[model samples]
Target: MLFGAKNSSNPRLQLLKDVVLFKDLSMRELAMVDSLMHERRYLADEIIFDEGEEGQGLFVVLSGRVKIARFASPLEMLIELGPGAFFGEVALLDQSVRSAQARALEDVQIAVLFRAEFYSLLETHSAIASRISFQLARVLAARLRQAVANTDRHHEAA
Candidate 1:
């Protein structure tokens, strides 16, 4: 519900620099991306986004913790994200239903990067966008590898 963090005195770019998605960006580039983002705050236990919802963008944690979970009958937790971490990254690339839900584990603040804004960046600043995209691909590939490894371990245990 919040828009850009320009009104706040806090250094948004400082937080942005630590985020993996923008790690390769310069201070100027990070400022450009920061201007495109809207800051949102969540209370403890609030759902940031729900499972099966149409993904629209990715959220980067600025402060506090978040839990990524598959809210099934058994409630399987996927991961816990903290400051400088990002989640819902796949949404930035395509329109798809989220496979997991993201919820605030504590009072949290985050910056959201919408897909439309990102696409515009791709058109106007391909260099910066491509850097982010490359990082995204690496993150996804690493997750895939970890998932496969977990599956193999489960199979061997069974």
Candidate 2:
């Protein structure tokens, strides 16, 4: 008999369960959302996406670290994220240019939730979509608040 032949642990499903965007979802609902995800991998120092490119979807880091940077005069490094963290989320709400470039700091695995698929979920599985949207809103709001706090701190130091 083959081990993990009939009952296997799915790594992707396991990763999705811990993601903040799907934290409120039950296992069955996460399985539904998992069905819509696309997976991609990147090597160390690879450009996952570039600044100013049209955003397509949100990417959740499955394994390894990713750096988010703004290619401006000073070349600011926005954030570095690891497993369970999601980025490019604004794309899910609108057709917009990516504000930062994401590059792999190490070998990375990511799961993508495209805008179109998320929209389809909103229409077909409204409850699941609503929960995700709520979580997304909370994440955005917290980021905005943190930005404001950081700006204030910078102003005070200068």
Candidate 3:
């Protein structure tokens, strides 16, 4: 569980400008997104989400840092994202279990978009939805390439 203050004045729209995923969205489009998402805050070292848990939505970092990690023999870090970055996008396409766990490195703020609400937004606003879809696809493609490269490195070492 988590709790914090909510900023009602254009915080979401400003966040849209920070996130590359929403770089193409206009002020009006961002405002629409603002209306659809909810904001939350987490204390430092908080586990935002756990790996293998069902993903319910996407999250945009509004402030502070988050580390994405996976557990095997030991915990392996995937990445650390700061303000302006976003994650959990895979849930938007499919309600798949989360691949990595996210922990806040500092007291953090994030805007969350729930799956049901996002789907409704898509149905109501086709253009913004298309842009988000394209952005997610590109991000996934890049991650896949990185994964393949990492696999090759591990194979060569063995």
Mind sharing the TM-score for model 1?
A: 0.92
Residue 127 accuracy (lDDT) in model 1? 97
Scored against the true structure, residue 126 in model 2 reaches a CA lDDT of 98
* Model 1 local distance difference test score: 0.92
TM-score computed on alpha carbons, candidate 3: 0.88
Clashes of each: 0, 0, 0
Q: What is the lDDT of residue 122 in candidate 3?
A: 80
Ranking by TM-score: 1, 2, 3
Leading candidate by TM-score: 1
lDDT of 3 at 107: 95
For candidate 2, write residues 27-76 as lDDT tens digits: 88888888788889999999999999999999999999999999888989
How many pairs in model 3 have backbone atoms within 3 A of each other, for residues 3 or more apart or on separate chains, i.e. clashes? 0
In order of lDDT, best first, we have 2, 1, 3
In candidate 2, position 12 carries an lDDT of 81
Q: Rate the local accuracy (lDDT) of all candidates.
A: 0.92, 0.92, 0.87
